[model samples]
Target: MRNEVIFHSEALEKEGNTLVQMGFRCDACGKTSYPVYELCPFCSSGEGSKTPLSNTGTLFSYSVTRVPVGPFKPPIIAGYIDLPEGTRVFGQIRADVKAVKTGMSLKVETGTIWTEKDGTEVIGYYYTPCGKEKGGAE
Candidate 1:
């Protein structure tokens, strides 16, 4: 599952250097959600569509985990962000990892989610932090 993730290559190349916005558009109520969504929770509308999310958002909540989970790395800074579009998302802090905190500004980056298909890795879009240098993590 870890190997199947896909990233917005352009954004990955610009992390920490600039702030980029990601967006998602709701087809049901015509509401826009940050990050991304497949279905509109409002009105239970399947008409929801995805759009790039806001680049800047306020850190709403956070935690620093010292242990690793699955294929994920340890000493990780994780948090929930309140995007400009009023949606919240959990993300990995990609900075020095110590400078992250609730209320801090964060840029959103897109990446691929990895999956095993026929014993081969496949990638798909996944959200990640963009406040650190490009290729900050392996």
Candidate 2:
């Protein structure tokens, strides 16, 4: 399943250089969760409705780490992003450790999370400084 797109496949698409992410709205509680959901984790309701997610969000929290996580090397920046969908997502931050701060504005980017041995591409969500040039690991 390494080649599988973890986020809802139908929810990802490219428009020019920007990537738009979508989420699911809880039919029961109206809570929103990113990348789709079988149930609302907040209300434990077994219902989800697909909805587009805004590319922009604010950095809720973050940390600088020299420890390796997944396909990324040392000095990785990790954080929780507070999306307009009302859900916070944990992801690899695409910025220098010294440049990250709480409440920083960001936007979603579509890029390689890693590549499989079969030469298949594994795409994943990443965030970067909003309105700025591509600002991190390439």
Candidate 3:
């Protein structure tokens, strides 16, 4: 069976052993939105096209959830990545607790973040170090 994306209808693309997300660029405003948007939220423009988002970005901010929630375990690393396209997207930061910090570099990824009671997989975007040195935990 094919994977189901949690966000847009068509966003995830698999290459080799990795999964990447496709963003939408507004033709009217030049704004880009992750998981794709029907209309550009920045300028409220409806004209847009599919654009591949850079897998690389800077770690803007992050938080570790000590209390477990849903299909995610405790210490769930979540944060915002400031992409070069001027879009700041949020996703799970898959990295060692010690290596993650503000201003760090990150790369976008795609995977199943959770599974519903009916066994439906929640596939979504995630992040990790751009260098892939510290490695990702998700």
Candidate 4:
């Protein structure tokens, strides 16, 4: 899914169909927002630029869904991650539900989250516990 069409192109940066990162920074208030906004939500300023979001962040909160939803498998982990730029992004966490914890370090990456009705893979951002945090050498 290296060059697949991203689910949300505006917020997810891409280079020739390859997803780069997510979010944009407000040129006025310097606040960052996900899902790209035409106007800054914090300052209501129209000046903003698309930028690659930080790959690493601290897990703020999370939940595990044991029941399947839509095309998602059971035991789906999703949560909010606080980035270094102060942007809080919500996305699926790719890890064991029992290992997920608040304040754990997470790294963002693009992957095939699901498929469309026509079978087109939808590439999107997902977070995983950092190697070090997962008891592995980084």
Candidate 5:
């Protein structure tokens, strides 16, 4: 079965089974926004286009939730990742809580985040620890 992503449909591009996150780059200021805003937040310009974001980023911060919420399992790990394009994105990190660290390099991947009421597998972007940059020195 194919996975379905419900939120921020305009900011997501699907190439077969792979999902790529997109950002809106303001034509006036060269600033980008994740989830694709209609207007530039900095320059207040409406002339911007959607562009693909970097697939890799550095972990800025993270938190572990010990309580289970809805379709999420206990000890859910989520963090803010600083992309190379100067955008900070918040996404769920698919890594061990004990192994998670600030400044670690992470690669974005698409996966099933949860199931819907109609039994659809909700897809979303997630981060996973990647090679090197473990000490945040990248």
Candidate 6:
């Protein structure tokens, strides 16, 4: 059996929005990871404590997708972002595809991915544009 794909809860969405709204650090490292583990990617340390990450970062790369690859809607904005913590995560860009660039500053927002309990549809979380129009959570 395949592992169930988790989705963002309203609370997570709210938390993400709140974090961004308050400009909270949002980087997850081996040490700073909520679950905790060995190896710190930033400091290359096997031990480190959790710390807030800088929310400001430039877009490393992006793609304007016209096809519905999975549980996401068509014309999805997908790409990788380089965090100030020296971490890179693939996230969904919430800006208009036409208006996006390779080095644009982006504010990370919360998203959800979901799949039907018994159906074939899957969904989950992604990074989207967060601001006044996108519920800045302010």
Best by TM-score: 5
lDDT of 1 by residue, 1-138 (tens): 333323443222233744344455776577775444466655656676556566567889888788987555677677888877777866666656666656766765544333344544433233344445443443
lDDT of 5 by residue, 27-87 (tens): 9999888878889888889999999899999999999999998889988999999999899
TM-scores, each model vs. reference: 0.57, 0.75, 0.77, 0.87, 0.88, 0.56
Q: What tens-digit string does per-residue lDDT give for candidate 2 at 17-108? A: 65567678898899888667677778889876777787778999988879787667878888899987678877778876777888888887
- Flag the better candidate by lDDT, 1 or 4: 4
Model 3, backbone clash pairs (residues 3+ apart or across chains), number: 0
- The list of candidate 1 runs beyond 4 A from truth reads 1-23, 34-38, 110-138
Instruction: Tell me the TM-score of model 6.
Output: 0.56
Clashing pairs in 6: 25-53, 94-129, 111-125, 112-124, 112-125, 113-123, 113-124, 113-125, 114-123, 114-124
lDDT of 6: 0.53
- In order, the Cα lDDT scores of the candidates are 0.58, 0.76, 0.80, 0.84, 0.85, 0.53
**Winner by TM-score between candidate 5 and candidate 2:** 5
Please report the TM-score between candidate 4 and the true structure. Answer: 0.87
Candidate 4: clashing pairs of residues: none
Per-residue lDDT of candidate 6, residues 30-105 (tens digit): 4233123345444555545434444555679888889888656778888887666555656677767766777666
Show where candidate 4 strays beyond 4 Å. 1-3, 16-18
Task: Estimate, for each residue in 17-130, the C-alpha lDDT of model 3 and write its tens digit.
Answer: 666678889998888897687888888888899787888999888999988887788889999899999988888888888888898889777767778777777877788787
Q: Which stretches of candidate 2 lie over 4 Å from their true place?
A: 1-19, 131-138
* Candidate 2 or 1, higher lDDT: 2
Best by lDDT: 5
Q: In angstroms, how far off is 104's CA in candidate 5?
A: 0.6
